[model samples]
Target: MSEDKSNRVVSGRVVSNAMDRTISVLVERRVKHPLYGKFLRRSMKLHAHDADNACNPGDWVRVEQCRPLSKTKCWRLVEIVEKAR
Candidate 1:
């Protein structure tokens, strides 16, 4: 039998709208500094697919990892967690 090995993709919200059909997602991670003992604020920008143009800034959303959608897009929006309020 073949084994399933699909990894769980991460989720984030749109942070910027500098490109067409694309949104900037701020992904946070905990990382200790070389001189510090506790974790610090670390973030990354992820390019996600927004085919419907429904995503907007300050809207909470869910994104999943997928095959490269474009030269810089590697994630797709799964759902809208919350709208800008």
Candidate 2:
């Protein structure tokens, strides 16, 4: 039997690419307040592995979850959705 496991995918903008073969992504999502019905924006900084270092700041990219590559990097870059001007 061929079994496939799907990994989590996240789309975000590249915030930083200072580290070698690594990039930081800023994922933002809107959530409603628990008490009030106010929509608030929340952002998270995620570390992903950029094998070819093809990502740049402000570049929209998609990352898929994978085995821990590093202490903070458990996600790997999949494709560049949009490039920054």
Q: Rate the local accuracy (lDDT) of all candidates.
A: 0.83, 0.96
User: What is the TM-score of each predicted model, taking all chains together?
Assistant: 0.80, 0.93
Regions of candidate 2 where Cα sits further than 4 Å from its true position: none
- How many clashes in each structure? 0, 0
Local accuracy of candidate 1 as per-residue lDDT tens digits, 1-85: 9998775577666898678878888877779988968889788889998888888898888888888888988888888889988
lDDT of 2 by residue, 1-85 (tens): 9999899999999999999999999999999999999999999999999999999999999999999999999999999999999
Which pairs clash in model 2?
A: none
Return the top candidate by TM-score.
Answer: 2
Error of 1 at 2 (Å): 3.4
